[model samples]
Target: MDKQELGAFLRTRRERLRPEDVGLVSGARRRTPGLRREEIAVLAHISTEYYVRLEQGRAPRPSGDVLAGISAALLLTDAESEHLHLLAGTAPIQTGLHRRDVRPSILTLLERLTQTAGFVTSATFEVLAWNDLAAALMEDFGALAPADRNLARKVFLVSDGDGRGGPLYGISDRAEFRQTVVMRLRTTMARYPSDPAVIGLVEELRSGSAEFARLWERHDVQSVPMLTKTFRHPVVGDVTVDCDSLALTDRDQHLVLYSAPQGSRDAEALALLSVLGTEGIDMVPDARR
Candidate 1:
């Protein structure tokens, strides 16, 4: 078990809960945030000392029953509960590097989506493959090396001259996208604790970006699906499109498609992107430099 991380996860979840949230009375002015440790232990039907040890990173691997009780007491969502299990070493963990190779059929599909900006991202958010439209809408992934194509890095590490994070192709949902990146990376790290690349990337982000460090400490595991997004394209102005992320479970990758309805203004913008293909505009900075 990752004792430190387990303790941290439990602590964060517990601290985010209020007494009223778990049906407990606020007997007095609480000193700390959320529900107290004693209350959590009481709700979980475990000893206060043991729960304290668990939160202190001094407890043994908790039994499934104990974990279930704690999960219920904390009122974790399904994703959060699964993350708790993963941190406590109670769930099945993927035991190797995350796959980067895209399925050939997926590559074919990207090519076939004539008007849509389609791309496939690895579990770590590396842009593995993309169509011409994707290259046009975003940056040209083909021009960069494998390491430079990670969306997480682009979102968190890359910044404008003022040191704030750069706009994600000037997407309207930049804030939500940052949250999604942290949530997904948290899940990825738990699943691939031993993978050097995963570990290094997370560490780099945490060290490089203060915003990333702040968000990482929250221990959030759930991500809301984004249905639509708008990008302030330098060439096409504002183009909004529907967002769809299809999981390629076999490879642990995602086929992300951005498209608009037929004959819509957004569709016309995408069509123009298909023809332009990063010709005159630099949507992204050169990562190689």
Candidate 2:
């Protein structure tokens, strides 16, 4: 690690902000350029002494995990975060838009899942592709801006369902769903530490949502397992489905499929949803007349 350069970089970034920028209070007579070393250490979940040693170029090189904590604490941009990793002798994050190409085979498979809610997403949870059933079951991914098509953005940026455009879980497992999504998201961010899209989404969420920031600070990381969620559809009432993910071996992408138990109300709802989609697809073109 370039300990001396790293020290200087940290000091400068820390000094550029005000106490209120990180939800800290400024008392009278308090004087620190941006945030004190102690405050940064606290935010990064590290020892004040250790952080001080690092800033003074007295500490050993930090691992990627330690750098990640510091990156989040400083609210570094994607480019800046990657620079931190490079200075610490860790691998830099990929500094560009997330790869969004879903394999043609995957698209065909998605189309064949008539009774399932199926969509394709990037490693960072950006919705790259989706089928009609998925569009019917959850929020419409196609309608959202390319950036807002991201699952993390939808979950964190949107408030509760009470708000006009807030996210609506429409199910009883809202907390579990959120916990799993956040855990998987943290894991994805680490896996692709330098991706500008992931870092941008995280920074945006951290700034706009205190709940997200709090959860993010905990540093929970995990894989998203096959689980079930219930969706309350306005036209079809409630539907419960098993959520499964199929990772595309060629790239950092996955196909998510949601299926309901046979003979169940959810299964019936899927059937109804398919019928609706079919009718829409079968409509005659206005210009053809």
Candidate 3:
């Protein structure tokens, strides 16, 4: 990543905020436009020299606590705080447990959501496990390769020839949507920098798509829980689905649910999903061809 640019951008953002923005009062005769380095250091409970070192890119690693302190002192946005942690190279701290081995109860919980399309995803956006409805709603989910089953990767790589992969639920503004996904992936990467899987996926995307690279450099972070999306299904035709993402508090896993909009034709299409399930049909293919 662009460490120098990150350092400079953070310093610039920190210097652009006024004391009043963070509920601090500034006395008269201050020469600078923003909080002074010493003042910020005091607020963050760090030495001026250390904070200076951080701004100068001399500090190799800063703890999450320190980064949080500085984030608060600077009144940073969520995206900015996440970016700060990434620049500090201390993000995505593991909790000393294998995320892949989360409680079996979660799997049971997913099975209970029969009417809705649901699945549990890892922090790196891998679809670790999914339910029947999820598989039927999105044909691509059924077609994901074992190694390339990632949301960000699918969004960028799964496309029709000539660079148009069709629309994500007939959404005309796909470029913005793609960028949003990239930003979220970048944020996740920042938090889990040591995850080789996550790193490798990013490197692959960078090499494959210039658009992804440009958006990654912007460093945007967002947590969108609920959205309405349309999908053009080969069998059912066009369907509008309401997608929701819920965080599993017990683990670093997220449960994603997809539902059809009430009173819409898609809702009728979803009803067919249960019939498919009852027939013992495995909608997801054993492999992507």
Candidate 4:
């Protein structure tokens, strides 16, 4: 195991974080940028001396539980999390190969959802196929370059007018949205370490958006909830709909359907969006940012 590299990596990860990131009160007089070793130790339930040994490259290899605690404390990304295992000489975590191809039946399902805003995405969140309602509601994925048909990159890099990007699907609760996207991307990274699409997207986002970089470092992971989401469209106004994700079994592709209940204002907005078609619709602009 590369003990020295592990120590250095851990130290660097720690230094990049601020106290407020982990719920600690920031002291004005502190000299360094991140949490102290003692604070990390306390958070990890380890002794200060043990953690110091870890940083000094003298400590024995850490167990899985110990690594998990450390990972949580430092907020390592999926890549960072796996790298920690290799450096620690432990068994690698299994983020098995993710399926990228969309099944025929899934495509049929997407097409059948005429009243709903529907689309299919690869494991890496690449926009594979989207309907007219989706295009009208959000940006036109079909018009985007195949390489640019990525959700994470659009969320983090694309701008409406200024350098900063516009709101995602006009969702106002941005923090929650960012967290959800980042978490899912991390899971995908773990599952497909060698995927050029996922890796390139990661590199692009890290270089482009400081916010994405910070969120990526946090290493959040979870299932995207089957919850109702609100979208504030420029033409149709506001529409709230339930977002449902259906996995295409072994194919690993996802069919995402957005639907509002009948007779609801959101349903009306969706209808208006369909009628509006491609008019008053613009997607992630320039992308030079």
Candidate 5:
């Protein structure tokens, strides 16, 4: 949102990196703070004048390829690269819809994995579909609002003060999990800038959560395929699950599969969850699902 701050931050980051950091060499008598403008230009495959113009915020909007070059040249973090995309108004294409209506396939897959819990979520964090085991493992997902459904939103935007939502169901280490999710979201946004759903989600988070705003300013990006999560289930008690995220490239969605070590207490709890469905329970209402 702050274009001048964005440009300044990027320039400062570039000035803090040495030529050697980006696989460049600087001979003796190099008195500059970091790599010279010409050095960065060469590394980024751009003219020195153009690079200078970019630093000065005088150049025209850059293409994605050019931004990638600059990102590499400056060693920008995933969040930073995403921030760059936002600043340049060329964020990645994040498709918000799961048009395949693959609920049946998802249910079948979940049925096959009786010992594990799994669910399918769209790029914008819509819980398109989930198996019974998944529903049992995480009770809140079954009670999500169709419009504002997402784990990240629940963690960050939910306010306990207002009796809405909060990190009531997530792990105690909520900050780290929030950062991880936001970073992943940044990566998604970078790849799908035009997705109105993603854009709207970002807007909502920015308005609703100061922590999200702070993290978003950092421009971090992360795409880890796996994560270890601990949840404090209201009914089943505390359980630890290793979550694996598989990107369904064919469908432009992702499958978040949860598993626990066999023979562990958590595993037993998950096993019990497999037998239960959304019955004989009052689903918590989440206005911003």
Candidate 6:
């Protein structure tokens, strides 16, 4: 069990709750945020001391019943409740390196996805494979070294050089995407805590980016779904597309497809990108180099 992380997660969730959120009265002006430990203990039907110990990281592995109580007390969502189980070692963990290999059929599907920008991302958000349209819509991932293909790295580490933030493909959902990256990485960390790459990547992001560090400390494990996004492509000006991410369950990866409705201007832009390829694109904006 990841005792420290579990404690941290519990603490964050508890602090996000208001007294009235769980039907408790706001008796007085509060000194700290969220419901108090005693209040949570009362709500969860556990001893205040034990809940405190759990938050202090001094408690033993909580039983399933105890965890359920705590989950209810904190009003965790389904994803957050599952994360609580993972952190407490009650759920099955991957316990190995995250898979990076893209299934051959997925690769073929990417190629067959005509006029659509398609790419597969590993558990850690590494771009494992992409079609020509993906390269055109984004940058040419095929030209980047394996280590440079990680989207989390690109999101947090690689800056746009104008003090804005990381290279976000000039996408309009930069903030949302960053949160999604952090939330998914938190899940990945719980699943593959022993994986060197995951460990190293988390360490690198925490140290390199203050934004990442702040988000990491929030202990969030759920991401709001991004339905549509607009990309300010250097060549195409703006191309808005519907975002569809299909989970490759066997490989623990995501096939992310960006497509615009047929007969739309965005669709025409995608078509143009398909033919242009990455001929005029540079992976990093020239100013960054």
lDDT (Cα, tens digit) per residue for candidate 2, span 1-289: 6677578778877887688989998767766578999999999999999999999999998877788999989988775686667667687444455578888888998899888889988877788999988887665566679777776666666666453223544665655656666656665565555677677777887788677777666544433464887776666667888988887845778888999889987898898877675343234243101
Against the hidden reference, what TM-scores do the models get? 0.95, 0.63, 0.70, 0.66, 0.73, 0.96
TM-score of 6: 0.96
Q: Report the Cα lDDT for residue 200, model 6.
A: 96
Question: Per-residue lDDT tens digits of candidate 6, residues 189-266?
Answer: 999999999999999999999999999999999899999999888877889999999989888899999999999999
Candidate 1 backbone clash number:
0
Sort the candidates on lDDT, descending order: 1, 6, 4, 2, 5, 3
In candidate 3, position 268 carries an lDDT of: 81
Candidate 4: tens digits of C-alpha lDDT, residues 199-218:
78878888988888887776
164 Cα displacement, candidate 6 (Å): 3.8
Residue 196 alpha-carbon offset, candidate 5, angstroms: 2.8
Q: After superposition, how far is residue 185 of candidate 2 from its true place, in Å?
A: 2.9
Q: Write the per-residue lDDT of candidate 5 for residues 1-289, one digit (tens) a residue.
A: 3345446656777777876887777679887677788887888898999888877877788888998998888888776777777767776443454343555666678678878878787766667777777777666465667764577777787787753337646565677767777776765665565677777888898889888888877655554444788877655668899888877776667788889999999998887666554441234344112
Model 1 global lDDT (CA atoms, 0 to 1): 0.90
Local lDDT at 38 for model 6: 97
Q: Which stretches of candidate 2 lie over 4 Å from their true place?
A: 1-97, 161-165, 223-226, 278-289
lDDT of 3: 0.68
Error of 3 at 19 (Å): 13
Lowest lDDT sum, 10 consecutive residues, model 3, at 280-289
Better of 4 and 6 by TM-score: 6
RMSD of 6: 1.9
After TM-score superposition, the amount by which residue 136's alpha carbon in candidate 2 deviates from its true location, in angstroms, is: 1.7
TM-score of 2: 0.63
Residue pairs in clash, model 3: 91-191, 92-191, 92-192, 160-165, 169-230, 169-231
Candidate 5 global lDDT: 0.71
lDDT of 6 at 144: 83
lDDT of 1 by residue, 1-289 (tens): 8999999999999999988898888777888889989889999999999999999999999988999999999999999999999999999999989998888999898889998899999889999999999988887788899888998998889887667687778788888999999999999999999999999999999999999999999999999999999988878889999999999988889999999999999999998888878773664355223
